[model samples]
Target: MSSQVIENHRANAEIYSGAPICIEKSRQLLDEISMPKGLLPLDDLVEVGYNRAAGFVWLRQSKSKQHRFNRIGKTVSYDKEVTAFVENRRMKKLTGVKSKELLIWVTISEIFIDESNPDSITFASSTGISRTFPVSAFELEEDGKK
Candidate 1:
């Protein structure tokens, strides 16, 4: 399937801790957790996890925000470019189902840092697929033997 890419900034760092987390970490966590990775403008997707019961969650990146500057006592506006999206795909089917059914696909429409808290980020997918799943759910069979 074709994909699109979008640029975002909030997902780059922790809003509260101000700790920088790489995109790779975000991807790893999403895969390990079996969270639905949302689709982007350029065939890109983001994996996300959440625990509604405990109010715990994680995301790959933060949202973009406008930056205001004071120039000669005047306010100027700019934007931060911390997160970005691009087309990506697996080189081959990691599963052994020999059919598309074995291949799990998810679409994500938007991703942004929580407006209330910069450290917290949220990823939203237009589809209704749930994000509360264990990482084992998406694991491909080892040695191509399912």
Candidate 2:
């Protein structure tokens, strides 16, 4: 992230630090934006910042982590810092996330849920390749609720 942008947002953003609350706040932000809470599933989040006016959000973790979406048998890597411009059902200009395909890892630039379909989410890579998967694949069953 650019220093100027970070400074500006920090001045106007809702900043959440510390592990426990950052985890909750991150999940809450996803819920508010119509995204699956488990979509991020970051570990040991150190900080999170959201600039609602600019739709910019960022997550900082203690270290890089990789998570596997068992439903799709795909793995995604999250850097220590992840940033994006987010809106309802969509995250654009994403940074710090990559998905492994075969032997290559591709940088995912955008993720969106199409209104017409809604049951699926599309991930577009910076390389221009895109893939769509069931939305439920990313949704988590919070607290074991049905």
Candidate 3:
């Protein structure tokens, strides 16, 4: 193959393997979860992988735990920041704007972290409405109730 062809092949392989594909799949899953009737029990999900052999995605609860759930059809559109916010919330990881799942259809306009209580996060909706959530409910990775 020519040098340009070899470079293109490597680029495509990179896009289809490892972190990039996993992150994109995670983002797609989060977008699906943001829609109505899109309740995904993600508190137990640690890693998600796309199965090229089976033509499906698999979600792993932990290093030694696994389970399967059916897929949903709806998807919600979100900006990059909101997508990262949702991903962090699903992973129960702390970010600058810590929060939990709020309204499904509304877009988040602003995030406010309560200094008095690091456990609380306030979110302003795109429609000018605000809501707060307690991060205490989601601080643990194994709080699988959702």
Q: How far is candidate 2 from the true structure (C-alpha RMSD, Å)?
A: 1.6
lDDT tens per residue, model 3, 5-44: 2233332232233444454555465445331112233333
The candidate scoring highest on TM-score is 2
- lDDT against the true structure, each candidate: 0.27, 0.90, 0.36
Which pairs clash in model 2?
none
lDDT computed for candidate 2: 0.90
Ordering by lDDT: 2, 3, 1
Candidate 2 stretches greater than 4 Å from native:
2-4, 143-145
Q: For candidate 2, write residues 22-132 as lDDT tens digits.
A: 999999999999988889989699999999999999998999999999989999999988898999999998999999999999999999999999999999987799999
Residue 29 lDDT, candidate 3, scale 0-100: 53
**Per-residue lDDT value at 113 in model 3:** 49
Between candidates 1 and 3, name the one with more favorable lDDT: 3
lDDT of 1 by residue, 10-123 (tens): 334232222232344444434443332321111111333323232233332234222211211212111222122321221111111111112443333333443345333333
Clashes of each: 21, 0, 0
Which has the better lDDT: candidate 1, or candidate 2? 2
Q: Distance from true position, residue 122, model 2, in Å? A: 0.4
